[model samples]
Target: MPYSRRAAVYDVEYTEERDVGFILGLVGQAAPSVLEVPCGAGRLSLRIAPYAGRLTVVDLEPEMVARTVAALEREGHGGRIRGRVADMRELRLEERFDLALIPREALQLLPPEEGRQALAAAAAHVAPGGRLAVDLATFLPVPGGAPDPDYYDPARTDGVWATDWIRTLSDGSQLVRQSAQHHDGMSIRFDLQYRVLQGGRVAEDWAAGMRLHRYSRGWIDDARPDGMAVEAVHGDYDGSDFTGDSPRLIALYRRGPAAGR
Candidate 1:
């Protein structure tokens, strides 16, 4: 139930689909087999399926897996992909993939140790000479960030999309508040509160505490799995080289000859 309960609300809340172009560029036109771990609601999976000869999507929450499966079926990709529930840390599959992706900075949601295991698990299924990629966020709070609590800042403004992240979900509820509870050097915990309105009246209230771990290029290099050589590392979705001041860490790797040794 980590993320399933929020499945429907989550599907509609975050409308933006991300990293498609950069990811697709890596997939190329080879029509190679691809694997996506924790495929969030199939938003990205649908686009990748056409380029993949065989697409396999997996998620830890059954609700997310179901939503992904339903989406693939709706989009006519059911025959090529199946979304299954499996923890990224413990996931074990016999097949190796031409490209394996961990999108949405998912590893951030896990503790450091678990995050490392997740990377290893994904690497284990990558075909030798194939590729592995992960996108993560480790931003330093915008220098002198929003002065007001109600201010919702845009992550990046390409002019195409810009909105406060907490604007209520139109389908049912609004995230009324998000407060930080605790933080160490490694992770931060948050208390999220929401209210669902019915006919302008309060219908339901939702609240939960969540934690997110942090990562950087060095963090990834230290935990790098065997045979996976760094191909490229970007600071943002625009594919710029990563630097110390970069807002995000997106790493791409290729499994070389030493794989599986």
Candidate 2:
């Protein structure tokens, strides 16, 4: 998901949740210098600026980076933020940060190999004794059977709630469409689709499929790169201990004594 094409609708489609603030607080407590990879639309960056001594954010999409810069300028934090367009797997910076964050399950978007590469790249930029934090979702069974239209209307802006929800299959892929109208004459719509392939053919298809890689504490701890250690894993933004039943996995890692420049 390049996400650049949908940059305009991204912010509205996915509103900030409580977890964002939780992550921001954790980052603020960990360090004053922060590095945020895949900082989409500057949503979290804006919140991080006031508490951070210096903030550096990067995204693979130029449009997203531009939006972040624009947002920073609008919020008067442009002077303190350094926004760049770069791939996390290939990131190379002369400076190190006291804290590095890959929030919003951005790591889950990549395949396992690419995800590892990105993690290593992120860890490389962490200053010794510093920290790296990543947010990921644990694998859960698809809502048990058929999708319910009413379940999709989790957000509403006025008297009108989301409706006309439908799911369809096309060329071995499934597509889901839903829309809602706001009181300000504006409307929000989402079209999500994905397919699972096997032997060059589609084996399964699902609507609203996130195509995310499910992560666990064991997996993260096992995948830690040299010079970095998994420090803690939380089930939520409130610093709860991660468990098999936890809905979210927020993993924090600390750089080893010999790590980074």
Candidate 3:
């Protein structure tokens, strides 16, 4: 229910996102193959298409897969991309990639146990000596990760605070997205709503929800399969050194020979 309904208007709601510079840099000028887990409307996939010799995008939503493949085709990269509607936890592709990334804090969206399994499933497809990059939202509306006062209003326990994004579409309709979240001791749960306005009146309404669990900073170290080790960790997308003051915990893991097929 989270992304299934949102896929209808996801592009209009999140079109301004331009945070792929670091991800592109990591992919470099070219890569033999690239695997994108949950290719949310192809935002990052479109950016990485040129550098990828071959791209395999997997997502749990069929609508998302269709949108991503359609975007790539529009960009003339359809022949080089494969879109699969599959759950990351049960994904067992026959092929491996030079780079496999679970971007935009997506891994955290799963329950802790499923998150680990999903990660392991991804790691299983990582070519020997290949790279696995995961972007983590370690510090959010929490105390340890430098919480933003404006973003988190502890006044509401049922729902701490809501962040809204409003955008105008080409057809003159205004789309408003409100994402409200709260920490439920174990995970941060989110409730999302989308409102479409036309002629100064609400025309349509849609809703979705998902959870992002808080993982220990070192959880990846333990969750990663054998023969994989942390190669690098960056604070943010700018490739800055990770620090306590950093707002994000982006990590890169390398799979070695011991990591079997």
Candidate 4:
């Protein structure tokens, strides 16, 4: 799918609307010279603006970056927060941040190789003793974990009407909507269309595939940097310690003073 197309529904559908206090209390222990990667519409960045010493935000989608920039300007924080159109895997910045964050499973959006590149770029962006934090949704990567076929009612209580069953590919790497609402235990298939709008006009139509990968605990350990120290692995942004069944893995990495010298 086009990044802009996805960005249109980003704020409403894809965003994880967790409280700022929840994330701030954990990150605030360290000063907030923070860089937020894939900061869609600058939601979290704006939320933590008061505490932030310096905020550098980046998003791959131009529309998202533009919206965030405009919002910051309207909030009179344009000078305090910098919004850029950049990819996390190839981030380039003049100054290093005291802390960096990849929120709402933004890291998982990338394939494994690109995720590695993102980690390398993040390592370069943080100063020695600086921290890097990643927040993800905890979900078991079981078969048919993708969104089921359903209709989204803009004005409704449930908001979205998900289908009863979703078809799974043999390789477990792909999922496609087969049918619409069906009776309990009765399977159905469906094909749906989505439209992206700009200025209230249809701009594009996105057709792509999506799959979920519940990152194993081993995945976090493998991502550890050569010179960086693993500060903490938490279950969530609330700073609870990680356990074997912890769904979310918030890995805090710190580059040691000696190795980077």
Highest-scoring model, TM-score: 3
Ten residues in sequence with the least summed lDDT for candidate 4:
181-190
Q: Against the correct fold, how does model 1 do in TM-score? A: 0.83
Off by over 4 Å in 1: 29-31, 141-182, 258-261
Write out the backbone clash pairs for model 3. none
Ranking by TM-score: 3, 1, 2, 4
lDDT by residue (1-261, candidate 4, tens digit) is 565764554444433445366668745878568888888877787777678878888988889988777877787777788888888999998878878888766776665556778887877888777888776544433234332111212122322344322322233322222212222121121223454444455544545334333455666778776678788888754677987655467787887876642
- What's the best-to-worst order under lDDT? 3, 1, 2, 4
Local accuracy of candidate 3 as per-residue lDDT tens digits, 112-192: 788889888998888888888888765444444334222334445666445566788779899887767777887767787
Per-residue lDDT tens digits of candidate 1, residues 1-261?
A: 355667767665545545778778877835389999988777788788878878889987788888888877888878888666899999899888989999866788887778889999999998878888998876454355431112223243222222235446656455443443455567655555555655577776666556767786787788788878888888867889988866668888788977542
Q: Distance from true position, residue 113, model 1, in Å?
A: 2.2
- Model 4's lDDT to the true fold? 0.63
Q: After superposition, how far is residue 44 of candidate 2 from its true place, in Å?
A: 0.7
TM-score per prediction, in order, is 0.83, 0.73, 0.88, 0.72
Error of model 4, residue 89, in angstroms: 1.1
lDDT of 1 at 65: 81
Model 1 has an lDDT value of 0.73
Better structure of 1 and 3 per TM-score: 3
